[model samples]
Target: MKKIFSFLFLQFFVFSIVFCQNQKIDGHPAWIMQGNIYEVNIRQFTEEGTLNAFAKHLDRIKKMGVQTIWFMPINPISVVDRKGSLGSYYAVANYNTVNPEYGTMEDFKNVVKKIHKLGMKVIIDWVPNHTGCDHPWLDSHPDFFVKDSTGKPASMFDWTDTKQLNYKNSEMQDSMIAAMKYWIKKTDIDGYRVDVAWNISGNFWKKCIPQLKKIKNVFMLAEGDSSYLPKSGFDAVYPWHMFHVMEKIAKGTLNAWAIDSIRKQTEKRYPANTIQMYFTSNHDENSWNKADYETFPGAVHAPFAVLTQTMAKTVPLIYGGQEEPVLRPLKFFDKDPMEWGKYKRAKFYQTLLELRKRNIALAPNASFKKISVGNDKAVYAFVREKAGKKILVILNFSATEQNITIKDKTLHGTANNIFMGSTETLSSKKWKMEPWGYAVYEY
Candidate 1:
């Protein structure tokens, strides 16, 4: 009797450990807590408008230290109620079919294979809240759509080109989950970036996530800022409020103090494990807001970039053509190809990315503690440390050179400067910063 009891106790203990290892919190596996992601826009990425063309650029992207590639929608676009020449990618004509304009199903599989071969994961964009008006499902299963008071199919958010999906229907929910699973099984894709995730029911995600986990551990990024989305299943959400704060700071409407306030508010609102996707420019901002050049001009770019990399709970994102410094906004619904040219900013980005990889302090979820705020509104300084690694980041947001002192005792001693590629020793006295200058020092 004693021997039988001992064997049963050991079996239970081993099973508990295995279960804990497989379980995920906030859509991320335990191992993915430290990594960087890049966003790819396939339609406008290259002139070919095909997966083959985009695959060629994977090597260049990998050199930038990007571990994951988040591709925009590749499914067939709805032609009915279409906007412009080529309808929005979000308006899906078919859930399972690949957009022929982008490539064939086999071509997409090849792209996925190439991405994995390069040791990187791919996540495709998913539009769950709505579908294009011409979608086949409308005729086959009209019950999948929401109805208005007039007893006709309803459209939400002034999106006349699209029809809203009815999440209350269990069949529609099952179909969505099946579609998600299809991508995972067929393409072997890593995960998804859920569009307008807040608009979808939380119960839908709660039911879908466990099913996805059975196929593979997937990372889910929600476009919405709602806290419950992450609590439900998403690993990361957009930092919309922080993005606005950055825009205000660049426009001179806010100062460095505003950065501190925004960080504090974020911590109080979300869980510590929740990753925030940070970027100065994305598809919407590029087309609607005149790109990052117009948004963040001249000397302010490097400083903000530094802040995004070293800040806590943040993962930097690089949109397509950002390295080429694409000045003009690529037109949506039109074949506007990026004109690649020589640019100095490419080197700047490469350096920052490499620094993030080498320094544990700059890794995701590392300790973020602000060290000093200068009397002048343009200078901001902070220190991040993890394990035995420590890094000090100083930024001069103004046009003119700023003379500041490192009064913080934690920043004392000689350190390697990331931007200038030199060694800088701080004596707790004064330091001079060049115009629009920024420094990442490893102590």
Candidate 2:
């Protein structure tokens, strides 16, 4: 009897192990596990700034190897207490409709269809934490908003153009979920990139995300980095901490080793397989802060960008004009069309994007092992491996050259340099890396 019981127990344990191995811990859509996201600031993508105009570039963008397209808020902007000639995208006036400035609702639907036909997923910005002051909810359901000391709807922070939503009201929460559902059911959009996601109640996301997924296997990305965002059903969250560290490294205030600390902290803070959206710049960083040219500046940008793309559990993001290599700060509340000059950086990105798509080692669930290549202060080296595939990435963060040696005997082998398109046998011989240089190898 004891022997029979032991056999049964072993069988159950083996079954459980296989079941866990096949399941995705992050709950992200299968398409996103190895994909990269591109932020489309439709307002500035083209001088026309219309959905139809943006459609003209679909083939070009598709060829660039973008897998997921994240459009900033497409809803109409509120005119009441508007900040400038054009209002903020986050000040959403309506949830169910498209911004007239960008074109009609049908135009956006057509664009989504085109994006899908091109084999890329589309996810629009969703503002659930607040609404434009002129939103009809202000009049139709005044109780849906948070009231101030004066008993009037209050603005979120100092953005007087927007009014914060009252999540405590169960009816409002239901309404918000319904609005989110309308997009999936009506437009066939793949998912949403929730704005100010941390500010919204985690309970709301827990309630909202499942319903959206029920309609389709939708991807959900939260703008905030709160650990609860992942627990609340977010497939990806902003890597605000690592992004800041990248900036500090570029400015020479921090070193490449700083990245490891962030990696360790993130592992401890979130559940296993939690994905982080990594980027050098986004809409906020471009407009409110500064462009990557100013933040990362020159050659330094390449290494950090490589880090974002090749890092473990990363779903890299390339803000619209980064390939255009937009150098100046984009105007947030007005027309600031992108001057796409010959797409100077297109090939540079294509190499990275395509590599991630084909490389199992760069998959979001791949295992990451830091390689000690010496000079931790100025150089970052790591290896990603999965299913017998291995990718080694080395980045020199400083403006000065780095001479380092790979001491790990296991890493010595013949590997192809994906960027240089060269094959070389690497060993204990010292290598001289250019200033702010980056390299990726498939061994």
Candidate 3:
């Protein structure tokens, strides 16, 4: 019994240490806590699909209150076994240069300068886990690639267009880090949104990211959802688990109560300071899967977008053209530019962005408390409070109207509906939420 007790104590100590890892984040930019990222698919952002073409839209993007712009891979794509006429952006062929297809390196530098002139930070997509088959290193440094059964370089799982990089070589790690530094020095980019970050070894990131930070105190976002990525030096990681659960709820495979439970589970998975990038749609969702039109159609998109904007330890992302409500699946390797219809949803997103900028309670470090109301199975409600400011959010996830009454003191008192511009005495009123409807009240 004494031996069992001693072993249990040892296990508890180890578990506690491991659980506390993500809570002690340092070196992350202070500006990120309240940031809203706009992921720009440069190829589809405009008809020209060039760096110069995209440059013209910077003024409008900045006017929308976006703090950061995440540009997709801008490096040349390898033509050897390339997927389509344009090839996947992830199949990077060059490390230290811009893709001529986009424009000359001079044009990219000019674009970065213009973005900085507008006081917006730009982060390019960094592909580190793999490279295109035609990468020069394939011949000069064959050891940089993962070997197949025949002892030649191998492409990762049906990604015949690209080759997986071998992380075992220390020289390869140094070269990759140097290449990452080259971009910052050349383009003065704010940072990187590392692609397939978890596929590479964590130790390599532990070495590389700190070096990158020394050159510039930049924010790094990992494509992976694992807590290890955050620990390895990424400022934020994807919240794919929550995104999948949300899709399930939209399909009626789960109820609104699942959100409360899932929120708890997600919190347990990360440390106190871990920032998760939350979103309803992204590059993959917009192309590979359905856009918001199919999955979170109509009012369904609003509540989920609200959840991302108000959730704790999260930075929301809006893919380019979301404001225009792009209704089709964007082709990954083809020139299917978004038709910029009248910016109908521009004000809607602008309101959310401006609210996030002005409201301290909606920041990532604010206090979040779940509030239960009538129709608990269909209504998801919560309050985010910071200092003396409180914002109450009530979202009806079901496809029918929900008559909900507030019994909690959090909703008591007069508050303004920022969206509808109406004042309500919420202390005793029963409210009806339209199907897939949401309301935000600020006091």
Candidate 4:
């Protein structure tokens, strides 16, 4: 009876949140259109926390079907007022060079070359909003930093280890753009994942991004969900709004259809061609909140992972150690390395990513139509169709059995069970999902 009441409550939430809309997209690089993203937290990626050490896992990552690798900041950290022993990656000491803790300039270049040789694009994390307190610019160019009301270097939030850069300073603006350009010119990296993108003014990005693009057809991802960000020149932005709803869904505080409502809200705000980076976990999430395992235990994660990868206008992100299924909170400002167990979820991610690469229906620009299976609450279903191919996902958001007969004619076709690796005829209509179970079929 308790389970029945809980399920009923979930259904009520689903009805309130379920809705839909589709947005068109453009200018997403042709190569990344169907690719999946992998974020590497260099400090915790390996015990060594060095570029040379992290290089050894390229083949394993490539085999996982990841196409783009977004590395967390590789710059020297500030020792002054440091948050922890190693300090935060966002505390950039130099905008133009590699952190010695990782590797030398030449070694970093070789690693980048190797990643390219394997046919994967690499984008480094760029902290454009601030610089470490010990940055050379702090000593030589006092006007480059944002000063507080007292006319002293300012810090973001309570981050005393770093000083914020003043984009209002025109000379500082040019220097920042030149430093970013220097990376493209030197290492030939694919692009950047800009940090605190919303904090910086649109004009600075308006001026800076175009200059970086001039050097190369770079892929730019903003660490923001602002609609203005995509308009400014970013290839993608964080789907924080959707991520919050997803967290609710994971905790059963919301229902599956909440995704539909969030998706609609997000689609209406951004222009066509903007991608949202969807992930179960990232550096900040792992370091601050509980890891995905703790947040969405067992079956709660698979369906969300499926949603992240196959949702319309999304590029899925796999944080390091996710394949290992990291179970602990990784220390943010220190060398609390991730454990590389027997690569438990490697195949799980491989299936989802490979499906994205091969299925046109999963493309960021493709059409996504939500399907209602059970009484609008218990079952959340959707279909992705493109170029004569279709993929269907039906998930049970509850922790009990759900039996629903999908009446939608659009889903009436033969499908290959993506997880079970068997043929399934949707003509039967009736389907059963175990407690927290998910069903995915591709046709």
lDDT of 3 by residue, 351-411 (tens): 7888888888888888998888778889998889988988999899999999988899757
List TM-score per model, in order.
0.92, 0.94, 0.92, 0.92
Give the CA lDDT, 0 to 100, for residue 251 in model 1.
81
Please report the TM-score between candidate 3 and the true structure: 0.92
Candidate 2 local lDDT, 291-346, one digit each (tens):
59889987878999999999999899999889878888888889989987688888
Q: What lDDT does model 2 reach?
A: 0.91
Strongest candidate by lDDT? 2
Question: Model 2: C-alpha RMSD to truth?
Answer: 7.3
Q: Taking the tens digit of each residue's C-alpha lDDT, what string does model 4 give over 98-170?
A: 8999989898899999998998988999998999989999999999998999999999888888999998899
**What TM-score does prediction 2 earn?**
0.94
Query: Residue 190 in model 2: shift from native, Å?
Result: 0.7
Every candidate's lDDT: 0.82, 0.91, 0.87, 0.86
1-443 in candidate 1: lDDT tens per residue? Answer: 99999999999999886675466643466434546677777888888888999998888888877778888999999888888898787888999989999989999999999988887878899999999888888999899999889876788877878899999999999999999999999999888999889898778898997898788778888998888887788888898998898888778788767888888898888877888888878888888797587887666777887777777777777777778788778787778888665645778788877777777777666787787735457887888888999988888766677888888766778898877788978766776888768888888
Give the winner by TM-score: 2
TM-score of 4: 0.92
Evaluate residue 237 in candidate 1 and report its C-alpha lDDT on the 0 to 100 scale: 89
